[model samples]
Target: MKKILLLSDTHSFIDEKILKFVKQADEVWHAGDIGNLEVTDTLKKLKPLRAVFGNIDGADARSEFPLDAKFEVEKVTVWMTHIGGYPNKYYKRIRDKIKLNPPKIFISGHSHILKVQYDKKLNLLHLNPGAAGNHGFHKVRTMLRFELDNSEIKNMEIIELDKRG
Candidate 1:
Protein backbone atom coordinates (compact mmCIF):
# COMPACT_ATOMS: atom_id res chain seq x y z
CA MET A 1 0.00 0.00 0.00
CA LYS A 2 1.28 3.44 -0.97
CA LYS A 3 -0.06 6.74 0.25
CA ILE A 4 -0.20 9.35 -2.48
CA LEU A 5 -0.38 13.10 -2.22
CA LEU A 6 -1.72 14.68 -5.40
CA LEU A 7 -1.43 18.40 -6.06
CA SER A 8 -1.39 20.81 -8.95
CA ASP A 9 -1.07 24.45 -10.00
CA THR A 10 1.22 25.38 -7.15
CA HIS A 11 2.47 28.30 -9.27
CA SER A 12 5.78 28.45 -7.37
CA PHE A 13 4.25 28.76 -3.96
CA ILE A 14 5.24 26.35 -1.21
CA ASP A 15 4.53 26.61 2.46
CA GLU A 16 4.80 24.65 5.69
CA LYS A 17 1.24 23.41 5.43
CA ILE A 18 1.90 21.77 2.09
CA LEU A 19 5.18 20.34 3.26
CA LYS A 20 3.53 18.81 6.30
CA PHE A 21 1.34 16.69 4.06
CA VAL A 22 4.27 15.85 1.83
CA LYS A 23 6.11 14.30 4.72
CA GLN A 24 3.18 12.02 5.43
CA ALA A 25 2.69 10.72 1.91
CA ASP A 26 4.68 7.98 0.26
CA GLU A 27 4.77 9.82 -3.03
CA VAL A 28 3.70 13.07 -4.67
CA TRP A 29 2.06 13.56 -8.03
CA HIS A 30 1.95 17.06 -9.50
CA ALA A 31 -0.49 17.65 -12.34
CA GLY A 32 0.97 20.96 -13.63
CA ASP A 33 1.17 24.77 -13.71
CA ILE A 34 4.14 24.36 -11.40
CA GLY A 35 5.25 27.97 -12.17
CA ASN A 36 8.90 27.24 -11.44
CA LEU A 37 11.30 24.53 -10.33
CA GLU A 38 11.39 25.72 -6.76
CA VAL A 39 8.01 24.17 -6.04
CA THR A 40 8.95 20.76 -7.43
CA ASP A 41 12.53 20.72 -6.22
CA THR A 42 11.34 21.21 -2.69
CA LEU A 43 8.82 18.40 -2.98
CA LYS A 44 11.46 16.12 -4.46
CA LYS A 45 13.62 16.66 -1.42
CA LEU A 46 10.90 15.13 0.73
CA LYS A 47 9.54 12.34 -1.47
CA PRO A 48 9.29 10.84 -4.93
CA LEU A 49 7.46 13.15 -7.35
CA ARG A 50 5.70 12.50 -10.61
CA ALA A 51 4.90 15.63 -12.59
CA VAL A 52 3.98 17.20 -15.91
CA PHE A 53 4.67 20.66 -17.31
CA GLY A 54 1.85 23.18 -17.58
CA ASN A 55 1.16 26.02 -20.03
CA ILE A 56 2.41 28.72 -17.66
CA ASP A 57 5.59 26.77 -16.93
CA GLY A 58 8.73 28.15 -18.56
CA ALA A 59 11.62 26.45 -20.34
CA ASP A 60 13.16 25.17 -17.12
CA ALA A 61 10.06 23.28 -16.08
CA ARG A 62 9.38 22.04 -19.59
CA SER A 63 12.90 20.74 -19.80
CA GLU A 64 12.45 18.82 -16.55
CA PHE A 65 8.92 17.46 -16.97
CA PRO A 66 6.89 16.07 -19.80
CA LEU A 67 3.69 17.46 -21.35
CA ASP A 68 1.93 14.20 -20.53
CA ALA A 69 2.69 11.58 -17.88
CA LYS A 70 1.47 8.01 -18.20
CA PHE A 71 2.50 5.43 -15.71
CA GLU A 72 1.26 2.74 -13.40
CA VAL A 73 1.17 2.45 -9.66
CA GLU A 74 0.18 -0.69 -7.77
CA LYS A 75 -1.74 -2.17 -10.69
CA VAL A 76 -3.45 1.11 -11.56
CA THR A 77 -2.72 2.97 -14.74
CA VAL A 78 -2.66 6.76 -14.49
CA TRP A 79 -2.63 9.28 -17.30
CA MET A 80 -1.83 12.86 -16.35
CA THR A 81 -1.40 16.10 -18.22
CA HIS A 82 -1.50 19.81 -17.58
CA ILE A 83 -4.49 20.60 -19.78
CA GLY A 84 -6.38 17.33 -19.96
CA GLY A 85 -10.09 18.06 -19.91
CA TYR A 86 -12.53 16.31 -17.60
CA PRO A 87 -14.91 13.51 -18.55
CA ASN A 88 -16.95 14.23 -21.72
CA LYS A 89 -15.61 17.75 -21.90
CA TYR A 90 -12.00 16.69 -22.21
CA TYR A 91 -9.59 18.63 -24.39
CA LYS A 92 -9.62 17.48 -28.00
CA ARG A 93 -6.07 16.24 -28.01
CA ILE A 94 -6.29 14.41 -24.71
CA ARG A 95 -9.71 13.03 -25.53
CA ASP A 96 -8.44 11.63 -28.79
CA LYS A 97 -5.59 9.91 -27.09
CA ILE A 98 -7.77 8.57 -24.28
CA LYS A 99 -10.29 7.21 -26.73
CA LEU A 100 -7.57 5.01 -28.08
CA ASN A 101 -6.17 4.18 -24.66
CA PRO A 102 -7.77 5.06 -21.38
CA PRO A 103 -6.22 4.90 -17.96
CA LYS A 104 -7.79 3.96 -14.66
CA ILE A 105 -7.19 7.48 -13.41
CA PHE A 106 -6.85 10.72 -15.36
CA ILE A 107 -5.46 13.84 -13.69
CA SER A 108 -4.97 17.39 -14.93
CA GLY A 109 -5.01 20.98 -13.77
CA HIS A 110 -5.36 24.50 -15.21
CA SER A 111 -8.88 25.76 -14.52
CA HIS A 112 -8.14 25.92 -10.80
CA ILE A 113 -11.34 23.96 -10.30
CA LEU A 114 -11.41 21.04 -7.89
CA LYS A 115 -13.23 18.06 -9.35
CA VAL A 116 -13.36 14.43 -8.45
CA GLN A 117 -15.64 12.48 -10.74
CA TYR A 118 -16.02 9.19 -12.45
CA ASP A 119 -16.08 9.10 -16.23
CA LYS A 120 -18.51 6.35 -17.13
CA LYS A 121 -17.71 6.27 -20.82
CA LEU A 122 -13.99 6.00 -20.26
CA ASN A 123 -14.30 3.88 -17.13
CA LEU A 124 -11.88 6.07 -15.29
CA LEU A 125 -11.67 8.41 -12.31
CA HIS A 126 -10.93 12.07 -13.06
CA LEU A 127 -9.17 14.09 -10.41
CA ASN A 128 -8.39 17.82 -10.61
CA PRO A 129 -6.83 19.06 -7.36
CA GLY A 130 -7.36 22.71 -8.31
CA ALA A 131 -4.83 25.47 -7.60
CA ALA A 132 -2.88 25.16 -4.39
CA GLY A 133 -1.25 28.52 -4.98
CA ASN A 134 -2.57 31.95 -4.09
CA HIS A 135 -2.16 33.28 -7.61
CA GLY A 136 -5.45 32.20 -9.19
CA PHE A 137 -9.15 32.99 -9.09
CA HIS A 138 -9.80 30.04 -6.81
CA LYS A 139 -11.32 31.16 -3.55
CA VAL A 140 -9.93 28.20 -1.61
CA ARG A 141 -6.77 26.41 -2.56
CA THR A 142 -6.80 22.60 -2.30
CA MET A 143 -4.93 19.33 -2.68
CA LEU A 144 -5.80 15.62 -2.62
CA ARG A 145 -4.51 12.62 -0.75
CA PHE A 146 -5.31 8.93 -1.22
CA GLU A 147 -3.99 5.46 -0.82
CA LEU A 148 -3.16 3.11 -3.67
CA ASP A 149 -3.35 -0.33 -2.19
CA ASN A 150 -2.88 -3.24 -4.54
CA SER A 151 -5.44 -2.34 -7.22
CA GLU A 152 -7.69 -0.30 -4.99
CA ILE A 153 -7.69 3.47 -4.70
CA LYS A 154 -9.16 4.46 -1.39
CA ASN A 155 -8.89 6.56 1.76
CA MET A 156 -9.17 9.79 -0.16
CA GLU A 157 -8.87 13.14 1.57
CA ILE A 158 -8.83 16.78 0.54
CA ILE A 159 -6.48 19.39 1.97
CA GLU A 160 -7.59 22.98 1.78
CA LEU A 161 -4.98 25.68 2.18
CA ASP A 162 -5.65 29.31 3.04
CA LYS A 163 -7.67 31.67 0.87
CA ARG A 164 -6.15 32.88 -2.38
CA GLY A 165 -5.23 36.43 -3.25
Candidate 2:
Protein backbone atom coordinates (compact mmCIF):
# COMPACT_ATOMS: atom_id res chain seq x y z
CA MET A 1 0.00 0.00 0.00
CA LYS A 2 1.24 3.44 -0.92
CA LYS A 3 -0.01 6.60 0.71
CA ILE A 4 -0.46 9.25 -1.94
CA LEU A 5 -0.75 12.98 -1.45
CA LEU A 6 -2.04 14.90 -4.47
CA LEU A 7 -2.13 18.67 -5.01
CA SER A 8 -1.88 21.23 -7.75
CA ASP A 9 -1.60 24.89 -8.78
CA THR A 10 0.84 25.76 -6.05
CA HIS A 11 2.00 28.80 -8.04
CA SER A 12 5.27 28.88 -6.10
CA PHE A 13 3.71 29.05 -2.65
CA ILE A 14 4.48 26.42 -0.04
CA ASP A 15 3.46 26.53 3.58
CA GLU A 16 4.10 24.56 6.74
CA LYS A 17 0.61 23.10 6.63
CA ILE A 18 1.26 21.61 3.22
CA LEU A 19 4.65 20.35 4.22
CA LYS A 20 3.17 18.55 7.18
CA PHE A 21 1.10 16.35 4.88
CA VAL A 22 3.98 15.76 2.50
CA LYS A 23 5.93 14.25 5.36
CA GLN A 24 3.15 11.82 6.04
CA ALA A 25 2.60 10.56 2.50
CA ASP A 26 4.62 7.87 0.81
CA GLU A 27 4.58 9.78 -2.45
CA VAL A 28 3.42 13.18 -3.66
CA TRP A 29 1.84 14.04 -6.97
CA HIS A 30 1.55 17.61 -8.22
CA ALA A 31 -0.82 18.01 -11.17
CA GLY A 32 0.63 21.32 -12.39
CA ASP A 33 0.98 25.11 -12.26
CA ILE A 34 3.83 24.60 -9.85
CA GLY A 35 5.05 28.15 -10.61
CA ASN A 36 8.68 27.41 -9.62
CA LEU A 37 11.06 24.54 -9.28
CA GLU A 38 11.78 25.29 -5.65
CA VAL A 39 8.28 24.23 -4.71
CA THR A 40 8.77 20.84 -6.33
CA ASP A 41 12.33 20.50 -5.13
CA THR A 42 11.12 20.84 -1.57
CA LEU A 43 8.46 18.19 -2.04
CA LYS A 44 10.86 15.93 -3.90
CA LYS A 45 13.20 16.19 -0.97
CA LEU A 46 10.47 15.03 1.35
CA LYS A 47 9.19 12.19 -0.81
CA PRO A 48 8.91 10.92 -4.36
CA LEU A 49 7.20 13.43 -6.66
CA ARG A 50 5.30 12.94 -9.88
CA ALA A 51 4.46 16.23 -11.58
CA VAL A 52 3.63 18.13 -14.74
CA PHE A 53 4.19 21.72 -15.83
CA GLY A 54 1.28 24.12 -15.96
CA ASN A 55 0.36 27.19 -18.00
CA ILE A 56 1.75 29.56 -15.38
CA ASP A 57 4.97 27.60 -14.98
CA GLY A 58 8.10 29.04 -16.54
CA ALA A 59 11.00 27.44 -18.36
CA ASP A 60 12.64 26.25 -15.19
CA ALA A 61 9.55 24.38 -14.04
CA ARG A 62 8.83 23.02 -17.49
CA SER A 63 12.39 21.80 -17.77
CA GLU A 64 12.01 19.89 -14.55
CA PHE A 65 8.66 18.35 -15.42
CA PRO A 66 6.78 17.36 -18.51
CA LEU A 67 3.49 18.75 -19.82
CA ASP A 68 1.88 15.34 -19.58
CA ALA A 69 2.78 12.29 -17.53
CA LYS A 70 1.46 8.75 -18.02
CA PHE A 71 2.57 5.90 -15.91
CA GLU A 72 1.50 3.10 -13.67
CA VAL A 73 1.67 3.05 -9.91
CA GLU A 74 0.71 0.16 -7.69
CA LYS A 75 -0.99 -1.61 -10.58
CA VAL A 76 -3.05 1.45 -11.49
CA THR A 77 -2.53 3.41 -14.69
CA VAL A 78 -2.53 7.18 -14.30
CA TRP A 79 -2.59 9.95 -16.85
CA MET A 80 -1.87 13.47 -15.61
CA THR A 81 -1.55 16.90 -17.14
CA HIS A 82 -1.96 20.54 -16.18
CA ILE A 83 -4.94 21.78 -18.17
CA GLY A 84 -6.83 18.57 -18.84
CA GLY A 85 -10.55 19.24 -18.51
CA TYR A 86 -12.84 16.79 -16.79
CA PRO A 87 -15.00 14.07 -18.37
CA ASN A 88 -17.08 15.25 -21.35
CA LYS A 89 -15.45 18.67 -21.22
CA TYR A 90 -11.91 17.35 -21.62
CA TYR A 91 -9.53 19.52 -23.57
CA LYS A 92 -9.68 18.79 -27.31
CA ARG A 93 -6.09 17.67 -27.64
CA ILE A 94 -6.43 15.16 -24.83
CA ARG A 95 -9.91 14.03 -25.69
CA ASP A 96 -8.80 11.85 -28.55
CA LYS A 97 -5.92 10.47 -26.58
CA ILE A 98 -8.17 9.60 -23.70
CA LYS A 99 -10.60 7.90 -26.00
CA LEU A 100 -7.81 5.90 -27.60
CA ASN A 101 -6.38 4.77 -24.29
CA PRO A 102 -7.99 5.82 -21.07
CA PRO A 103 -6.16 5.43 -17.84
CA LYS A 104 -7.66 4.15 -14.66
CA ILE A 105 -7.16 7.57 -13.15
CA PHE A 106 -6.87 10.96 -14.80
CA ILE A 107 -5.60 14.05 -13.02
CA SER A 108 -5.29 17.69 -13.96
CA GLY A 109 -5.33 21.22 -12.55
CA HIS A 110 -5.82 24.88 -13.48
CA SER A 111 -9.45 25.61 -12.68
CA HIS A 112 -8.63 25.79 -8.97
CA ILE A 113 -11.89 24.04 -8.35
CA LEU A 114 -11.84 20.79 -6.42
CA LYS A 115 -13.51 17.97 -8.35
CA VAL A 116 -13.58 14.23 -8.15
CA GLN A 117 -15.74 12.45 -10.66
CA TYR A 118 -16.22 9.04 -12.17
CA ASP A 119 -16.63 8.78 -15.90
CA LYS A 120 -18.66 5.73 -16.66
CA LYS A 121 -18.25 6.00 -20.39
CA LEU A 122 -14.48 5.88 -20.08
CA ASN A 123 -14.41 3.82 -16.93
CA LEU A 124 -11.98 6.07 -15.12
CA LEU A 125 -11.71 8.41 -12.19
CA HIS A 126 -11.06 12.11 -12.69
CA LEU A 127 -9.51 14.22 -10.00
CA ASN A 128 -8.63 17.88 -9.66
CA PRO A 129 -7.13 18.74 -6.29
CA GLY A 130 -7.75 22.47 -6.71
CA ALA A 131 -5.25 25.19 -5.83
CA ALA A 132 -2.88 24.72 -2.97
CA GLY A 133 -1.44 28.19 -3.39
CA ASN A 134 -2.76 31.67 -2.63
CA HIS A 135 -2.27 33.08 -6.10
CA GLY A 136 -5.49 32.12 -7.82
CA PHE A 137 -9.19 32.98 -7.75
CA HIS A 138 -9.84 30.02 -5.53
CA LYS A 139 -11.38 31.03 -2.23
CA VAL A 140 -10.00 28.02 -0.39
CA ARG A 141 -6.79 26.03 -0.78
CA THR A 142 -7.07 22.26 -0.92
CA MET A 143 -5.24 18.97 -1.43
CA LEU A 144 -6.07 15.27 -1.59
CA ARG A 145 -4.74 12.21 0.16
CA PHE A 146 -5.46 8.60 -0.59
CA GLU A 147 -4.08 5.12 -0.54
CA LEU A 148 -3.19 2.98 -3.55
CA ASP A 149 -3.13 -0.65 -2.67
CA ASN A 150 -2.88 -3.47 -5.17
CA SER A 151 -4.63 -1.49 -7.90
CA GLU A 152 -7.28 -0.09 -5.58
CA ILE A 153 -7.53 3.61 -4.89
CA LYS A 154 -9.04 3.99 -1.47
CA ASN A 155 -9.07 5.86 1.82
CA MET A 156 -9.53 9.23 0.18
CA GLU A 157 -9.14 12.34 2.29
CA ILE A 158 -9.51 15.95 1.33
CA ILE A 159 -7.19 18.42 3.08
CA GLU A 160 -8.14 22.04 2.97
CA LEU A 161 -5.87 24.94 3.81
CA ASP A 162 -6.94 28.41 4.91
CA LYS A 163 -8.61 31.00 2.72
CA ARG A 164 -6.51 31.98 -0.27
CA GLY A 165 -7.14 35.68 0.18
Candidate 3:
Protein backbone atom coordinates (compact mmCIF):
# COMPACT_ATOMS: atom_id res chain seq x y z
CA MET A 1 0.00 0.00 0.00
CA LYS A 2 1.22 3.45 -0.86
CA LYS A 3 0.09 6.53 1.01
CA ILE A 4 -0.50 9.38 -1.39
CA LEU A 5 -0.67 13.08 -0.72
CA LEU A 6 -2.40 14.98 -3.52
CA LEU A 7 -2.26 18.76 -3.73
CA SER A 8 -2.36 21.60 -6.24
CA ASP A 9 -2.45 25.35 -6.81
CA THR A 10 0.20 26.01 -4.24
CA HIS A 11 0.98 29.32 -5.89
CA SER A 12 4.43 29.54 -4.30
CA PHE A 13 3.31 29.04 -0.75
CA ILE A 14 4.25 26.34 1.67
CA ASP A 15 3.88 26.20 5.44
CA GLU A 16 4.49 23.98 8.41
CA LYS A 17 0.91 22.72 8.40
CA ILE A 18 1.29 21.41 4.87
CA LEU A 19 4.68 19.91 5.55
CA LYS A 20 3.42 18.06 8.57
CA PHE A 21 1.10 16.05 6.38
CA VAL A 22 3.62 15.70 3.60
CA LYS A 23 5.93 13.93 5.97
CA GLN A 24 3.36 11.24 6.59
CA ALA A 25 2.64 10.41 2.97
CA ASP A 26 4.80 8.03 1.02
CA GLU A 27 4.42 10.03 -2.18
CA VAL A 28 3.15 13.42 -3.27
CA TRP A 29 1.22 14.13 -6.45
CA HIS A 30 1.01 17.74 -7.54
CA ALA A 31 -1.68 18.51 -10.10
CA GLY A 32 -0.30 21.97 -11.03
CA ASP A 33 -0.36 25.78 -10.85
CA ILE A 34 2.73 25.25 -8.77
CA GLY A 35 3.65 28.92 -9.30
CA ASN A 36 7.32 28.29 -8.54
CA LEU A 37 9.81 25.48 -8.51
CA GLU A 38 10.68 26.06 -4.87
CA VAL A 39 7.37 24.56 -3.82
CA THR A 40 8.19 21.42 -5.76
CA ASP A 41 11.80 21.39 -4.67
CA THR A 42 10.68 21.54 -1.08
CA LEU A 43 8.22 18.71 -1.52
CA LYS A 44 10.69 16.61 -3.46
CA LYS A 45 13.12 16.88 -0.57
CA LEU A 46 10.54 15.26 1.66
CA LYS A 47 9.06 12.56 -0.56
CA PRO A 48 8.66 11.27 -4.08
CA LEU A 49 6.79 13.75 -6.24
CA ARG A 50 4.68 13.32 -9.37
CA ALA A 51 3.75 16.62 -10.94
CA VAL A 52 2.63 18.53 -14.03
CA PHE A 53 3.11 22.17 -14.90
CA GLY A 54 0.22 24.61 -14.74
CA ASN A 55 -0.82 27.82 -16.47
CA ILE A 56 0.76 29.96 -13.76
CA ASP A 57 3.99 28.01 -13.75
CA GLY A 58 7.01 29.52 -15.44
CA ALA A 59 9.82 28.10 -17.55
CA ASP A 60 11.60 26.57 -14.59
CA ALA A 61 8.57 24.52 -13.61
CA ARG A 62 7.75 23.63 -17.20
CA SER A 63 11.30 22.44 -17.67
CA GLU A 64 11.10 20.24 -14.60
CA PHE A 65 7.59 18.87 -15.03
CA PRO A 66 5.48 17.79 -17.94
CA LEU A 67 2.27 19.28 -19.28
CA ASP A 68 0.68 15.94 -18.64
CA ALA A 69 1.83 13.17 -16.30
CA LYS A 70 0.76 9.63 -17.12
CA PHE A 71 1.87 6.76 -14.95
CA GLU A 72 0.66 3.96 -12.72
CA VAL A 73 0.69 3.36 -9.00
CA GLU A 74 -0.03 0.03 -7.45
CA LYS A 75 -1.44 -1.27 -10.72
CA VAL A 76 -3.74 1.74 -11.15
CA THR A 77 -3.34 3.76 -14.32
CA VAL A 78 -3.24 7.47 -13.56
CA TRP A 79 -3.25 10.58 -15.70
CA MET A 80 -2.64 14.07 -14.34
CA THR A 81 -2.80 17.53 -15.87
CA HIS A 82 -3.20 21.06 -14.62
CA ILE A 83 -6.36 22.22 -16.37
CA GLY A 84 -8.27 19.05 -17.17
CA GLY A 85 -12.00 19.48 -16.73
CA TYR A 86 -14.26 17.09 -14.93
CA PRO A 87 -16.55 14.52 -16.50
CA ASN A 88 -18.86 15.84 -19.23
CA LYS A 89 -17.40 19.30 -18.94
CA TYR A 90 -13.79 18.29 -19.58
CA TYR A 91 -11.50 20.88 -21.10
CA LYS A 92 -11.64 20.69 -24.89
CA ARG A 93 -7.93 20.19 -25.36
CA ILE A 94 -7.97 16.87 -23.56
CA ARG A 95 -11.57 15.76 -24.08
CA ASP A 96 -10.92 13.67 -27.17
CA LYS A 97 -7.78 12.19 -25.72
CA ILE A 98 -9.50 11.29 -22.50
CA LYS A 99 -12.33 9.61 -24.33
CA LEU A 100 -9.90 7.68 -26.45
CA ASN A 101 -7.80 6.53 -23.52
CA PRO A 102 -9.16 6.71 -20.01
CA PRO A 103 -7.21 6.20 -16.84
CA LYS A 104 -8.26 4.72 -13.56
CA ILE A 105 -7.63 8.09 -11.95
CA PHE A 106 -7.69 11.54 -13.55
CA ILE A 107 -6.40 14.57 -11.64
CA SER A 108 -6.40 18.25 -12.45
CA GLY A 109 -6.32 21.64 -10.74
CA HIS A 110 -6.90 25.31 -11.57
CA SER A 111 -10.38 26.22 -10.41
CA HIS A 112 -9.27 26.10 -6.77
CA ILE A 113 -12.36 24.01 -6.13
CA LEU A 114 -12.16 20.81 -4.18
CA LYS A 115 -13.76 17.91 -5.98
CA VAL A 116 -13.78 14.14 -5.80
CA GLN A 117 -16.15 12.56 -8.26
CA TYR A 118 -16.42 9.25 -9.95
CA ASP A 119 -16.98 9.48 -13.68
CA LYS A 120 -19.27 6.57 -14.29
CA LYS A 121 -19.34 6.99 -18.05
CA LEU A 122 -15.58 6.77 -18.31
CA ASN A 123 -15.09 4.61 -15.24
CA LEU A 124 -12.51 6.86 -13.66
CA LEU A 125 -12.00 8.82 -10.49
CA HIS A 126 -11.60 12.60 -10.85
CA LEU A 127 -9.84 14.58 -8.15
CA ASN A 128 -9.13 18.26 -7.69
CA PRO A 129 -7.56 19.09 -4.35
CA GLY A 130 -8.51 22.76 -4.57
CA ALA A 131 -6.03 25.54 -3.75
CA ALA A 132 -3.46 24.62 -1.19
CA GLY A 133 -2.02 28.11 -1.31
CA ASN A 134 -3.46 31.46 -0.21
CA HIS A 135 -3.16 33.09 -3.61
CA GLY A 136 -6.53 32.20 -5.12
CA PHE A 137 -10.24 32.86 -4.70
CA HIS A 138 -10.67 29.70 -2.71
CA LYS A 139 -11.86 30.37 0.83
CA VAL A 140 -10.52 27.14 2.22
CA ARG A 141 -7.10 25.66 1.57
CA THR A 142 -7.34 21.94 1.01
CA MET A 143 -5.55 18.75 -0.04
CA LEU A 144 -6.27 15.04 -0.32
CA ARG A 145 -4.79 11.85 1.10
CA PHE A 146 -5.46 8.30 0.14
CA GLU A 147 -4.03 4.82 -0.04
CA LEU A 148 -3.36 2.83 -3.16
CA ASP A 149 -3.20 -0.88 -2.58
CA ASN A 150 -2.73 -3.20 -5.49
CA SER A 151 -5.38 -1.91 -7.90
CA GLU A 152 -7.68 -0.57 -5.24
CA ILE A 153 -7.89 2.98 -4.01
CA LYS A 154 -8.96 3.20 -0.42
CA ASN A 155 -8.93 5.19 2.82
CA MET A 156 -9.44 8.50 1.11
CA GLU A 157 -9.33 11.57 3.31
CA ILE A 158 -9.75 15.27 2.65
CA ILE A 159 -7.31 17.52 4.48
CA GLU A 160 -8.53 21.05 5.06
CA LEU A 161 -6.17 23.76 6.22
CA ASP A 162 -6.88 27.04 7.97
CA LYS A 163 -8.95 29.55 6.03
CA ARG A 164 -6.89 31.16 3.30
CA GLY A 165 -4.51 33.75 4.63
| Strongest candidate by lDDT | 3
At residue 38, what lDDT does model 2 achieve?
A: 87
- For residues 72-161, what per-residue lDDT tens digits would candidate 3 score against the true structure? 999999999999999999999999999999999999999999999999999999999998999989999999999999999999999999
Question: Which is superior by TM-score, 1 or 3?
Answer: 3
Give the runs in model 3 whose Cα sits over 4 Å from its true position. none
Instruction: Report the C-alpha displacement of residue 21, candidate 3, in angstroms.
Output: 0.7
- Per-residue CA lDDT of candidate 1, range 48-132, in tens? 9999999999999999999999999999999999998899999988878898999999999998999999999989999999989
User: Candidate 2 versus the native: TM-score?
Assistant: 0.98
- In candidate 2, stretches whose alpha carbon ends up further than 4 angstroms from where it belongs are none
What are the root-mean-square deviations of the candidates from the true structure over C-alphas?
Answer: 0.7, 0.7, 0.6
Q: Ten consecutive residues with minimal summed lDDT in candidate 2?
A: 56-65
The alpha-carbon lDDT assigned to residue 97 of candidate 3 equals 97
lDDT of 2 at 101: 97
Q: After superposition, how far is residue 52 of candidate 1 from its true place, in Å?
A: 0.4
Q: Which stretches of candidate 1 lie over 4 Å from their true place?
A: none
The C-alpha TM-scores of every prediction are 0.98, 0.98, 0.99
List model 2 lDDT by residue over 1-165, tens digit each. Answer: 999999999999999999999999999999999987889999989999999999998988888899999999999999999999999999998999999999999999999999999999999999999999999899999999999999999998889989996
